[model samples]
Target: MKILLMLRDEFYQANPGLIEDAKKLGDVRILYTDQGIAKDELIKEVKDVDVILVAVVKIDQEVIDAAPKLKYILKHGAGYDNIDVEYAASKGIPVTNAPGVNAQSAADHAFGLMLAAARNIPQKDKEIKSGHWELSMGTEVYKKTLGIIGFGAIAKAVAKRATGFDMETLVYTNHRDLAEAEKLNVTFVDKEEIFKSSDYLVIATSLTAENRYLVNQETLSLMKPTAYIVNVSRGQLINEMDLMGALEEKWIKGAALDVFEVEPPINHLPGMREVVATPHIGGATFESIKRIGDLSIANIVKLMNGEELEHVVNGVHSRVTQR
Candidate 1:
């Protein structure tokens, strides 16, 4: 087996142990890219690779079609949107992601954003650093309502942490998972209720065709003028222009985002004081990276051994036959 690691050079540089470890499975090759490589280079590098371990790079249909020996595409983290899963499925290549591996890190970052926005932490830090001794009023999390847009593993983890601050949680998901919600002592509500009731609203959902721009102008209109919003999930969940309008109009008091519709967000995204933005680092913690790496490696080992793969996201099943 020949494994192609389609990851950042920094990642390859940092994890020499992982490279040595991959030798246990196959002859591993490292191909670095800043999210994506040129089509020609990608085609050249991917040819005859048995497995591709992808890190944030976009593996489109063109690249997928060029790889004749490719049997598997393993995602380093929970999101597989960067891969062309439908096309891969058509070609009988199984695609899998390391789900729940970074849930704790992601949840922690979401709460960090919530507190940062609510307390004006970033601005105050700047003021104090500039030799100005000033006090800024920050909102107290105690007894406040926290609305979670999705009640998945990460959202559940956030709700669990919110308990330390004595928050009341309301959740809005496609379908209510009543048992889990009850376990967390959270209430399930409609989308509008989530907007109306939360003192701090955290967008924790995945990006899907149906939910793209889920928090648009109309949804923003429903939020409290004093409320704060935090997004730790995919950036396209909130419409950027509508968020800009909402901030300009004070539809919501403030926002802290770990992801953006466009990375290294240009234009008004970087210029707004009402917004606190991160370069999509919600799952970038050291612990999360290690966990993701371990899970991804385990999947690769399973694939090479002709065993059932775990965390298969695109409905591809076990290749191992039971006769």
Candidate 2:
């Protein structure tokens, strides 16, 4: 079996033992990319691979079509939105992702962003470094309303942390899972109600065709002027232009984003003082990366040994078997 790793060097740096572990299942090869070049280079490398472990990289139909020997495509992180899972499934290739492997790390980062944005932590730190000793007026989250967009593993993790802060948790999901909501001690509400009531509106939902730009100008209009927004999920979940307009118009107080519609956030927008943006480090922690790597490699080993596959995002797991 031939395994291809198309991920960052940092992933290997964090989990140095994975290389040895992967060698037990198959001959492992790596394709490290820093320039985001996938189509041409990835096509050249994946020709004879049995499995490909990818992270934040686009494996489109073009790349999938190029891999003749590919049996499995394992995402290094929870989100498989970057990969063309459906296309791979059509080609009888199983796609798996390590979901809940980094849920706690992402959840912690979501709340961290909320606190940072609310208190202007970044701005104040910058000012303090510039010889100013003033403090920014930060809002309190204790006993406040916390609204979550999705009720996934990471969202549930956030709900648990919110409980620690004595927050009133409200959730808005496409499907109302009353039992699950009750277990989390959360109230199920509509989107309108979530925006209207939350002191801090956090977007933990997955990126889907239906919910893209779910938080737009119209929805922003419904939010309390003093409320804040935090998104540890996909950037496209909120419209960039609408978010900018809302901040400029004071529709909402501020935003803390781990992901952006366009990474590196091309153009400048108003209200930088109110926005705390990170380079999508929600699942970049050392512990999270190690767990994700372990799960990904385990799935590859299962496929190579004709064992039951875990975390199969596509329905093609049955097609992948031992050589």
Candidate 3:
């Protein structure tokens, strides 16, 4: 069995031991690349692979067709939107992702970004480093209204944290669990109310075709000028151009981003002190990676050994064994 793992250089650096463990399962080929890797290069490398473990590089029908020996395609993290799981299923290739393993890690980072944006933490630190001493007025998070876009694991984890700050959590999601909302002390509200009432708004909903660019000029217009928006979810959810205009016009207080639509963003909007950006490191903690690594490798081993597959996103697991 041949297992091909593709992620950035830093991820490999953090999990040298995990790579070694994967070698114990089969012939492991690791690629150091980001999400925007060329399709030709990916096709060339995947020609004879039995398994493909990818982080960001998309696995469309072309790449799937190129891998004649392909049996399994595993996402190193959540958000299998990068892969065409339905197409892979049609081809009898099983696709799975390590989902919800980094909920706490991502939730922690979301809260951190919220506080950083609200308090202008990065801006103040920069000023102090440049030999300036002055106080900047920051928003008080204590007892503020926190609005979340989804009710998934990460969102739930975030709502749990909000309790400690005595925040009123408002959620907007198509999949409403009233019992869970009552238990967490979060209210299920509409999108307009979420935008209008939140002191901090977090985008945690899973990215789908329907909800892409969920945050636009109309939504931004509804937000209070003092409210801050933090996205710990996929970047495409927010219209970057619209967000840029809002920031320039002070439509909202500020924005903090963990992901960008075209990462690493071409513009970055470095001149805008109101914008704080991170390289999608919400789930990059060492602890979270270990959980993803263990689950990913274990799934791969199961596939190779003809054992029961876990975390199957595509319904081709049974067909894969037949092939």
lDDT: which candidate is best?
Answer: 3
Instruction: Give per-residue lDDT, candidate 3, residue 46.
Output: 98
Estimated TM-score per prediction?
0.93, 0.95, 0.96
Write candidate 3's Cα lDDT for 60-139 as tens digits. 99999999988889898888888999999988888988889989999999999999988889988889999999988998
What TM-score does prediction 1 earn? 0.93
Q: Between candidates 2 and 3, name the one with more favorable lDDT.
A: 3
What candidate 3 gets wrong by more than 4 Å, as runs, is 318-323
What is the Å distance of residue 81 in model 1 from its true position? 1.3
Q: Which pairs clash inside model 1?
A: none
Model 2 agreement with the true structure over 1-323: per-residue lDDT tens digits: 88888776677787877888888787899777645664677788888887888887789998888888888888988888999999998998889888888999999999999988778889989999999998557889999999999999999999989988999999999877777788879998988999999999999988999999999988999999999999999988988899998998998999988888766567564238778888788988899988887887777767867777898888876454564
Candidate order by decreasing lDDT: 3, 2, 1
- Mark the regions of model 2 whose C-alpha exceeds 4 Å error after superposition: 269-271, 318-323
**Per-residue lDDT of model 1, residues 38-104, tens digit only:** 7788898888788889887779899899898788899987877789999989888899988788899
RMSD of each candidate relative to the true structure = 2.5, 1.8, 1.8
Each candidate's lDDT (Cα)?
A: 0.85, 0.86, 0.88
